[model samples]
Target: MTIHSISARRANRSAEARVADQGWRELASELNNHGCAVMEKLLSPEECAGIAALYPHEEHFRSHVHMARHGFGKGEYRYFRYPLPDLIGALRTALYPRLAEVANDWNERLGLAQRYPADHAAFLKQCHDNGQTRPTPLLLQYGPGDFNCLHQDLYGDLAFPLQVAILLSEPGRDFTGGEFVLTEQRPRMQSRAEVVPLTQGDAVVFAVHNRPVQGTKGHYRVNLRHGVSRLRSGMRHTVGIIFHDAK
Candidate 1:
């Protein structure tokens, strides 16, 4: 076989690997019903540990944020710089098109005109053109008594509808009392909260700001915010993949 043929076959396999996963259809259905879906063991324990280990390396990140200083809660997080780590960059590229399909569907249901492009690079170009050039992927760390405030991940005008967070530390072994929490605010109704269960290497994809919810009359938009409950003991680590760039 020619070298070009082998390369083409490899590329096709990569593309197929991204979208042909068994769980994607189920994930979409769950997102349509609930504003969030969990992808269990998206990474292996070794991969999770490798990512969490990057948290202490200053060269990998662009900026560090102290949550208390910004009134964002108690923990700390660091935004990754450009040229993301290979696994993260690959995951970001692989996951976007799948989520974009669901995002476009939600936009149509909510009567919004915006549509996401099928690929991550094109969507990123759109963000960069609008002056949002900073990468949004981040590593977050939490210790005893630490927590994150409920907030949307919107960084600018061109926010992607969905974002993902992967738990890098084992819950029962590495932490306790720190739970992933999400809240939904419906019009003329009380806010509802959801506690997402995650283990090491597990990921949860959820609304970044708003999502369409079905009602008696038609689909309505519901505001969403996610955070972490206070940690009572030990430590925890997580990685966030936000498709849109920050200004």
Candidate 2:
């Protein structure tokens, strides 16, 4: 990339962070009400493509997963290394405080004793203290006939309640039928399936494990798992920002 391109990307990211700052309240409201929220066009198309391009470079990743080998699904993904990409790191930093506030509120409602720190660094320090030193940010790639199994992104003992996944490939043009799928399981009710709509540069923020729901007597916990439907054609790529580190 040229210096001008790099500068443009930085400006784009700055603008994106501003958007997150302004929209966080609405986003939190959606999370409290629906357990998920979509932030549209958080990244520019060039930025998205830039991120996806990084996936092929082995030095940027600490580990790779063939989802089928682990029964995770049919696609593949790679966990980022110690030094995350500039864009990813900025996103993790910019978005954490807002999500932390939502997470703290949920903890109170659910009667959970643990409260998260206000910033990502402190929370990460806590994770590292608990021996969760592996970075969990990842890039996932899906091809035709590939899919992801429904699952939570919780890494270790300490997990952030919310996580974000940004679509790096155009839905209709770059891939087909690989929709973002989320499932919610209430205590005594049948699971509800939600298909999230996302285009290139869009991001979906959701509960990483469980969310609190209002019940007749009190707040109850509902489990959530997210995945992708099988792609009918072409290739897809996504950037997952999992706040917690792995063991």
Candidate 3:
């Protein structure tokens, strides 16, 4: 099988099983080692479908011009904001609670949860003391022939080091060309990037910044630079969740 196939297979496994199967620990170790890690199928198929159902296709999704030069280019790209109520409304009462639970569990495992209750308390307290607040989630939709640039999602003073995306389109079905690429290895200027083509019901998690070295006041974070390969045909829909301090 191809590397992508292997990665996809690894990602498609059960989250709990993956965690127990050494992959989760390996992923966490990689994040600790390289400042980033990419995991697939962070969400269940049912949950992914529920999220897609709530995605508003008719509502206007603002084109992200802020990083157009980076590779976003100019075509059809839209953004959607999500509030807690909206999430509950979209996913329905029955599913919202479970989804929230899953989100919290994921956050805790990824070390993004508030620290006071955990080992990262000092860091969490520092962020709160520094005026960082929670950030809202958003949905990104790319239409046929659309694309986006590679840039970071830096908002406010909150130190949001993780970002996630839920795939709503089926590969080779609802879309054919949009692929998520990340700079892997090489010099900063000539870094080799990896493309992660996802299918419906797939979820990806990645770190937004690098951990700080010793003596640093804060972690050295980079904007999680990412973008879609041109969508040759069909539409691509994704739900992005960015966790941050409440403003």
Better structure of 2 and 3 per lDDT: 2
| Candidate 1 Cα misplacement greater than 4 A, ranges | 1-19
Sequence-dependent TM-score of model 1: 0.93
Q: Ranking by TM-score, best first?
A: 2, 1, 3
What digit string (tens of lDDT, one per residue) describes model 3 on residues 1-247?
8975564444434433433433555655555554344556545666666656654553423234333454446443334432232332222222223223333444555456443222233344555677753433555667776777665666666545555666877888787888877653322435446576576766565555433222244333232356667888887767765554344
lDDT of 2 by residue, 172-241 (tens): 8998999999999998889999999999999999999999999999998999999999999999999999
Question: Model 1, range 1-247, lDDT digits (tens) per residue?
Answer: 9975565555456545744664888999988887899988787898889989999899999999999999999999999998787778778888898899999999999999999999999999999999999999999999999999999999999999999999999988999989999999999999999999999988999999988888999999999999999999999999999999999
**lDDT accuracy of residue 173 in candidate 2:** 92
Report every candidate's CA lDDT. Answer: 0.91, 0.91, 0.52
Compute the lDDT for candidate 2. Answer: 0.91
Off by over 4 Å in 3: 1-23, 32-38, 57-134, 184-189, 211-224, 245-247
Q: TM-score for every candidate vs. truth? A: 0.93, 0.94, 0.58
Using TM-score, give the best candidate's number.
2
> What is the lDDT, from 0 to 100, of the residue 25 in candidate 2?
79
